[model samples]
Target: MEFKDYYEVLGVSRTATADEIKKAYRRLAHKYHPDVSKERDAEERFKAVSEAYEVLHDAEKRRAYDQFGHDYRAGDEFRPPPGWQWQPHTGAHARSHRGPNPAEGFSQTDFSEFFSSLFGEGGFAGFGERAQQHARGRHSHARHGEDVTRPLEITLEEAFAGGNRALSVDNGSERRTLNVRIPAGIAPGQKIRLAGQGTPGSNGATAGDLYLEVAYRPHPLYQVDGRDLTLELPLAPWEAALGAKVEVPTLGGRVTLAVPAGAQSGQKLRLRGRGLPGKPAGDQFVRLKIVNPPADTPAARELFQKMADTLPFDPRAGLG
Candidate 1:
């Protein structure tokens, strides 16, 4: 298999500090996240960057890779050093091919054969702080896998009413599709945790968790403010002056809204408890906008003149 130079992959110098490596990884991860990026090779690039960070972010893993990997370059044919032998991080490696609990280990899918050969499957099992213990050859109790978090974008309707989502995520080495449940009334920036779905632990340690942060897509007609929903309510001149019941849209369904007499543009009407779901559900605010008929025809012009004459009101009094 071809060797992978993780530091080069992250665009960092081999001598870069851990903090620098972390900054580089975060910058690349944000730029290449498949869901948000429009770049042609976003998925592939994202996977490579994630794999690089997985190895380099850990002190022990970085040490081992750097110490043993210096002689190689990216894409160079790689073979283990002479006298090298696979040492089991967990006794389970002796029991069977199962080696270690799959959930506790880092994902090896989509990894270069080079990485797989070096770390093997159990390499990332003790990925958390306990991984440092493994480097010292100390026998530690069960360790939890490191948690993973990613952004998830949803529509307004989906945010209003929780729904089952089918999503694909980078499960360490490869992209894996999953059926995720979105909680109702979920707001942007709120995270949903999927237990035991992250990096696996060594030996019999518990697997880490995965977190999905909620983000809402831009809607054509509505803007969200926390749990509250805001929309422009267009009204005819007569409806604003004489009052009328008009149908407005909500996630649940259409609601008939009563337009009070003398309603004006920019006036806000509140529909209580009609927004996103929560302990005390949010309200929906409708800003009224009165639209006048265009005087394109003779009759329309005549009617407008008649109204101008009949209801004499100075709109610019305040401005004056």
Candidate 2:
């Protein structure tokens, strides 16, 4: 039979601590587990990993293997030492064999011929039961799948009006399309959870959830602050100097706004409950921007000159 380097199979150092050996075994076992792994050689790898762990994880078996296995490399033709014999009922071996019956639910035939020759077919009775229990425990402690969060960008119009949106999500292995509902007034950074849409769970556990964080796409006419909306309203010079009921655009629709007399540039006018819909909904703020008509025509130049002559107010009066 060929010699097996149990430490090399588990990817651990010869002097590795027990805990390190167990950790390496668990990681490889989980990766190559036949039920969960997609690798073509997963079943073969899993069997190899399990076989390596069985001998290394047991103290007496590990000690005997190390004392004799040091001279032989993996795949080398191996033979037991000249006078060695299988002694399962003697001294230290007798004490270690007191646990569960290894043959009750396990078969030594499943292991390699090398392992059978090294430990005798029936000598590993205790460890076989232990390995079976470990497999059962791994399934009993199955973990829930992890939650995944991603950003979802939408137009301001879509945010203002609640509606359904079709979103395509790719999770490495496959692409899926989902219909998501956007709640009216859903603010940036708020999350929408889709149940059982994230990574799949192990051992029949429930799948995790998918979270979509809300974000607004850039809009041409409005700036968003939470649920509030701000728009720069351009006004003629005459409209600012004298009060006027001007047409204003809001998320809901167009509305009339009463500009106070002598309204200055940058002055803000508020329209309650006109920004986004919700409980005590947000307000729309219209910022005044006075636009002066250009004096390009001869008649427009005369009108501007007349206004400059008649209006004696100095804009720089506040300057020291």
Candidate 3:
């Protein structure tokens, strides 16, 4: 059979790190997954990517593959060295003496002839037995489905208020709609899991889970840091010089904030428990930005000239 260059298939270098390989695999898997991809050759590409990851992600498999893979190019006729055979040890590759079972969901039939030649027919036969040991009295042919993770983008408001969101997912030949709950105070990079929502299992096996990683869409008025929020509040010169109560917008709603007398630009005022909700809720910080009224009209210019003459304050005195 022809040799497969797994690194080339995944578009990564031979010296790529395990994390790099995993990232590459996830990106390709998401792009080419048969349930969601629009490309005509998506199924084929997805299978190839999965097979590549299966070998590359395993340290033992990778070491063995690299030992003899240097000489052959992809698609070239290839064969294992004479007297070469696979022996299982500890870890995921451990095998039972039950021999090759074609009924297993993960087998040589699921991958290419090239893969089988490299890793043997029964290499993955023990995967289901080991991974699903908790499963009781399962059919001999049953196999759990693959888990999937995808990014879910939500608005800041939705994250703060906690609500139900409708998400549509495509299964083999149909569309499935799922209503997901958004918890209040859910932070970015947190994951929400849905059980039995991933790829369907075979022969009555339980399906895998689906994970939605949360991320926030850009908000126009606020910047988030963990659960805390920062809002730039603009104020007139008089409002800063003389204390004033101003209406400020927060995640919860508008609230009156008292600006201390002699408030300077960039001064921060904290509003306790005004950010995201939790046991100890985050606080919102309003940063003061003093704005000078424009002297576009004659009256405004006269007022500015009057202040310059009456106020004996020289701003440049400190600079010298």
Candidate 4:
């Protein structure tokens, strides 16, 4: 997967502060929302803008992204389908769609969920509150409870096919385990919400949501890029030059990687649909990192001498 420049997505610069980015996201998304707009590609554009906002609005996600570039989402990539689902009752979306100030620190997805909660899918919940308020404005009790965050580490295999994750958290010094169904193709720093799992509520309402921030323990030899998995495959000089079928590890399992004869070091090979799975699975990138064996033995020395005498290739011929 290619690097998604969220700053570019929201039409802002890297130097733009959180507030500026938020404003841009709202302006662009509101213009493109399908409900009010008749423009072509409005829905697609709206999803893009919302996706961008989901990253830029959060301080931690933004910082990780700025430091690592594409590597920010190395463990996961948070791409929701055109119609996204969220568990708002979990207080995971605390800052979105509350009072007048709900706009202060919300990703568009959070805001959209708030609307979705009040008005069900296809507007089934509808917009009765807004219409009824015209005759008699009621006090807005839809206060956003505090957002709860917890860190979780998953294996490379689990990261690939996301699903319901059973987890526990300490709230008021008490731990409670809950099951959270993670979406497939989730990337690191992307939050998973468990609705109605947050702080104690007033008005005898149910508890709020618990937000689980996804991360991972580094897997040996495997590095993630968006939904794609990358591996720096070490090969012997002979295998790289003479072509071989070498077994390599993928998140799914092991598969034989084809090495073309005379393939250069740092050559990249793509394994189609072998990465993180979703509606459309991502590809795996195998970068060939050639390793020359040490000439510790006479046999190794003789092999090197023979190769040096026969091979006519100049490895660094490009540098003048």
Candidate 5:
């Protein structure tokens, strides 16, 4: 696919900041989620917006994309042109991707790594200390510890079944592994608190609890609603019209289903106690849709012709 304009996808201007981009994505994603959208093209529109946001949300990719325009590509196949990181035409020229490129004038001291990484740590540690030396003070009494925030993505299946999740996070200095238990019926924006898992505090105070906000990735076979699992099942024309016993798949497994005689396409069937596991298991709904059989054989065409002649009802008669 040709590259989509991230700004247009989010319905914002090119000058929009990171925070503005995030706000736009949140609003659009929630509106166009496949489970809730009623527009015919909602799902396709959702995926497009998501792809655009994914690129625009990354600082590196966004920079490269803004420089290269539609030439940018994502995924593991990302390959930047030679000298792509440096350009005299860009404001970023003041500093190399490797901090300010310095000569021997540095007094034998060198600083590498990104500025954001440094500031996240002790890069600013001397700010309060140096001022304190002039004021006859040693340190500032503050919540003087790094606050840890990491995003945790969960699949819809895992989110449905409340369980323990283990995640690894690097909080500037240390790599901490956290195992958190999730509660059932948790919403997408719900946060899972972790007691005393943050950075070390001053004056021997305790650490802060790590907060995990849950979000879901798209599922290949299922869609999630609040405490429910929705799926689209393809049924043969015979199955939809002539009432047959078919196997319906659920999170638990497949079970035999009875298709009521004269069932129409797009009919929804509810399977009780087969949805996402909650206090009381929610119902699983299957939307049956009919598909035309491939006309690979003469016999198949002949059989279909016979049925077409026999059925006198017009399924779309009422639609003006």
Candidate 6:
């Protein structure tokens, strides 16, 4: 195993405040977001950022990392400390002793090898053995299974209205397809719990729940701010100056939006209750983006010359 410096990954000091760490994570996440970023390595970079944040953001994990990582530098060859039962790259040993058991449920595939080494896959060092003991009815304690959490990405449209999805989950032994219902008015970062859908319990105890954390896929035309939606409404310069009603796409359908007279570029107009559906639904803001016509034709050039000769408007006057 190699020591990974999470602080260095986030470009923050070891003594950096929680707020600073959070800001750095958010900025890097946005910069490397796979859907929007043009960078060839955006996806890999984003994953690394996310992994770093996952550890540094947690107080317990951060404390453990700071203590154990004090003597090591990033990328240094690492070995487990005394009494720690971690064997790096020991696949054959892991399979023989800690192999996957159907009742133990599936392993969390989202985390990296570094994270798994630190956290020990799930809650215990040898979960498969414990599960096997429980199956044989030899285990004394009856403990509930550990809860599972997975990321779920949904489109803005799908988020607006409740929908159903078929998902394939690896339940240790096999891949099981399950139908999931997405509740109406679901928000990002919120979890949808599925009862008894996690690891099977030990000694016939009740199973834990599965939580699906909601995330939004990037949209080309709109941006989500909590419940509110923002969209850039492109308009001709003349249309912006002289108010006009234009058709705009919404989650519900296309609707006519009235632009006020003398609307400037970046001016925002609100549509009440037109955003994601909920009680006291969110509003949609349409921001005007005035697009000037190209002076390619003789008639267009003549109009531009006429405006330049007649109008006394100086757009750069504010710069003074």
Which candidate tops TM-score?
3
Error of 5 at 146 (Å): 6.2
lDDT of 4 by residue, 195-267 (tens): 4567754433334556668897788877888778788999998898889999988878899989999887789
lDDT of 6 by residue, 1-320 (tens): 88787877887755566788888888888888777799999877777777777667765456455545544557988866655442222333223121111113223455567767875643222234443553466656778788799999998888998788887877689687766667667888877656557787876665665678899999998989989999999999888889999999888899999988899998999989999877678989999999999999999999999999999999999999
Candidate 3 residue-wise lDDT, 86-173, digit = tens: 6445454464222111123434466888877766653532233333442354567788789788899999899889788899988779
Runs of candidate 4 with Cα error greater than 4 angstroms are: 1-145
lDDT of each: 0.74, 0.74, 0.77, 0.63, 0.59, 0.72
19-81 per-residue lDDT for model 1 (tens digits): 888888888877877778999998778778877877787654565565445445578878776
Candidate 3 local accuracy as lDDT?
0.77
Off by over 4 Å in 5: 1-147
For each of the candidates, the C-alpha root-mean-square deviation to the true structure, in angstroms, is 18.0, 23.2, 18.6, 12.1, 19.9, 18.1
Weakest 10 consecutive residues of candidate 4 by summed lDDT: 118-127
- Order by lDDT, highest first: 3, 2, 1, 6, 4, 5
- Superposed by TM-score, candidate 6 places the C-alpha of residue 2 at a distance from the truth, in angstroms, of 57
Q: Candidates' TM-scores?
A: 0.55, 0.55, 0.57, 0.54, 0.52, 0.55
> Across residues 1-320, which tens digit of lDDT does each residue of candidate 5 receive?
23445666787544467898888887887777777889889866776666556556655445445543322322223333343322122244223321112122322112212212212221121222322442453344445345455567787657666677667877658887766655545667766545446676564433454566778778888877776787888888777777899888876678998989888778998998887665577788888888888978999899978878997977689996
Model 1 weakest lDDT span, ten residues long:
95-104
Question: Candidate 5: deviation at residue 186, Å?
Answer: 3.0
Off by over 4 Å in 6: 1-141
Error of 4 at 34 (Å): 20
Higher lDDT: candidate 2 or 6?
Answer: 2
